[model samples]
Target: MSLLLLAPALLLVGVVFLWPLLRYAWLSGHAASVLTGLVPLANGGANWQRLLSDGRFWQDTLQTLRFAGVSLSLELLLGLALALLLHQPLRQRGAVRAAVLLPWALPTTVMALGWRWLLNDPYGPLNRLIQGLGGSPYGFLSTPATTWLFTVLADVWKSTPFVALLLLAGLQTIPPELEEALLLEGAGPLQRLWRLTLPLLAPYLLLAALFRLAQALGVFDLIQVLTGGGPASSTESLGLYAYLNGMRFLDFGYSATVMLGMFLLVLLLTSGLLLLRRGWQGTLR
Candidate 1:
């Protein structure tokens, strides 16, 4: 009966999510480019072989992984702090919490474009401030080292609130009596946080990490609008590379293969995180 109740949702999910993935998988095994008249023909692992030796694909993979790791780390850390702060009692706390979420609520393109203008060479406020301090205006968007770092920062700023909200909900579910008991036992703030709060909050942290990791790994709009994968493709994500292969180069088969590879990479990393979480729980036991 329970399975029957979920049948519609399961079917919907299959069609919406599973269908596209299956289509991509099928397309990946064929040749479907302008040279092939955009018709998919079986290529017998040719695309996969090419992917193995594709230097640019590997470079984009590294960049994407780095971006996801750094940004997700920052987001998780800052989000936990913000969640703890919001979990406290304060005047106008609802308003404050809502304000904190504004960044996450904004459309991604809007936020990315805003960052692009803010980091524009010579005219952005940051550069203006640098000039006032007697430094030459810097090309933030045109610099390789700094550009990727800023993209991570921009991603962190926008996504942290979402992680915070998830953690705050987790905090809410924590029984107050547990904390009271700890306090009566002479537990300090840090002690309670480390011993009680974090352990209980582990599931939420895992949830937030998994969600943010998927988003960060598939980051496209922000990098596209902000950097356009410029400065020698320093900040190019796998999603953007796939987009370029499909749209710019008109190679649908290779593009599909890239997308499938990205899906596998995400699956691998998230699975590893889940395994770690399970091991952690075992140790806690």
Candidate 2:
């Protein structure tokens, strides 16, 4: 009876998600003409071969990793700080926490547009502020380094709030008595954090990191709207590259290969993290 009840949802997932992915992976090995319906030919492994040999593909992969790494690191740090701040009792804590969600709640496209305006090379608030501070107007999206920096900043801005919220929830689950007990034992704030709080927060932190990493790895809209993988392909990410290949160039075969590659990589990475977390939890037990 329970299995019958769960059948609908399972059928929906199989039809809507698994079907398309399997179809795409199967088609990715075919020739472009076959994909476009111009001819029927199975060129096994050609798409994957081309993708593997493409320097641009490797470059985009590196850029994606770099962007994810820097953004997630900063977001984790800032989120921890914000979570700690909100974990304490304060009169406006509720209001502040709600406000923190604004960035995360806003649509990614809108946020990207707002950031684009803010980082505009000419007549933008950011550049104006820089000039006012006796610095030259800087190119944010048009330069390689600046593009990466702004992309990281945008991601961190939108994502850190979510991280803070997760960590705060974790904080609430922790019994207050633990901190008080540590305090009574002459533990300083730093010592308490190291010896008590962090240890308890480990699972939550790992889970949060896993979620953030996946989100960061798949980032597309913000970078697309902000830089469009421009300035000599400096800001090209795996997502954007896949998009360009699939939609822009109509190279569905190659795009599918890229998508499949990304899917496998993310799956492996996430699995590894979860395994590590499980091991840690077992050790703690």
Candidate 3:
């Protein structure tokens, strides 16, 4: 009876998730492009082989990992701090949270465009400020050395609020008595956070980590709108590469292969996190 109750949801999941994955796997083995008249032709491992040898693909993969790693770390750290601040009793807490969430709530394209203008060379506000200070206007979006860093900063700025909201919920779940008891025993703020609050909040932290890791790995829109994987492709991600192959280069087969590669990478990382979650749960028991 329970299985019957879950059948519809299970079917939906298969259709929405499983089917696309299966299709990509199958398509990755074929040749489908303008050369092939846009019809899928059995290519038998050719696409995968090309992917293995493609230097650009591997470079993009590395860049994606770096982007995800750095963004995830900063977002988690800053988010925790912001969450802690919000957890305090303050005037107009609701309004404060709304303001904090504004960045995350805005459309990604809108935010990306805003950042692009802010960092634009010569005439942008940042450049104008530099010029005012007797410094040359910096080419933020054009310089390979600084472009990727700005992308990371933009991502962190937009995403940190989301992480803060998750951690704030976790903070609320913690009982006030736990902190009160620690305070009575002469425990300081940092000590109570380390010993009591953090331990209780471990599950929530892990949850947020998993969520951010997955999102960071699959980041697309921000990179697309903000950087466009520019400045000699220093910031190109696997998703952007796949997108270019499929949409720009008209290579469907290779695009499918790239998508599958990204899927495998995400699966491996998320699987590790899941294993860690299990181990943590076992330790709790």
Candidate 4:
């Protein structure tokens, strides 16, 4: 009866997500018809072949992982700090929450544009401030390292609040009496955090990390607008590269393959991380 009742949702998933996913998977292994713009019936390993041999693809893959890893790490640390701070009893807490959420609530393109304006080489307030401090005007987007640094910073600013909100929700679930008992025993704030709070909040932290990791993997707009994948295609993520291929170069076959590979990699990594989280939770018990 449960399965029967869930039939509608299953149908919807098939039509909206699974069907298209399967169709794209099929297309990924086949060549696109040049004349008709349809997928050919014959299988062509050309797309997959290119991916295996392409150095640029490997570079983008490494950069994507690096960008996502750094940004997610920063977001988790900052978000945890914010959650801890806000969990305390304080006046004006509501106002503080609102201010913190403002950046997260803004559209991503808007945030990216704001960062771009701030990082402008010649006339940006940041550069002007540096010039006033007797420092040379820096090329924020002119190098791989600096361009990626800003990309990670921009992502962390926009995403940290989300992580905090999730963690704060988790923090709220803890009993206040436990902290009181710990205080009576002369446990310091740091001690209580390590022994009592961290064990409890680990699940939430992992959950937030997983969410951010997924978003960071497919990051496109911020880096795209900031660097246009240049100073040498150094900041080009898999999503941007696939987009350029499919739309700009009109290589639908290769683009589809890239998308499929990306999806599979994400799925595998997500599953592996979740399993690790489950094992860690078991150890905690």
Considering only N, C-alpha and C atoms within 3 Å, which residue pairs clash in candidate 1?
none
lDDT of 3 by residue, 206-251 (tens): 8888999998888888899888999899989999999999999999
Model 1 deviation from the true structure expressed as Cα RMSD, one decimal place: 1.2
lDDT of 4 at 225: 80
Could you estimate the TM-score for every candidate?
A: 0.97, 0.94, 0.97, 0.95
Encode model 1's per-residue lDDT on 3-102: one tens digit a residue: 9999999999999999999999999999999999999999989999999999999999999999999999999999999999999998999999999999
lDDT preference between candidates 1 and 2, better one: 1
Model 4 clashing residue pairs (backbone): none
lDDT of each: 0.96, 0.87, 0.92, 0.87
lDDT of 4 by residue, 129-202 (tens): 99999999888878776688888989999999999999999999989999899999999999999998988999
Candidate 2, 38: how far from true, in Å?
6.2
Cα lDDT for residue 48, candidate 3:
97
- 1 or 4, which is superior by lDDT? 1
What lDDT score is found at residue 285 in candidate 3? 78
What lDDT does candidate 1 reach at residue 159? Answer: 98
How well does candidate 2 score on lDDT at residue 154?
A: 89
Question: How far in Å is the alpha carbon of 74 misplaced in model 3?
Answer: 0.1
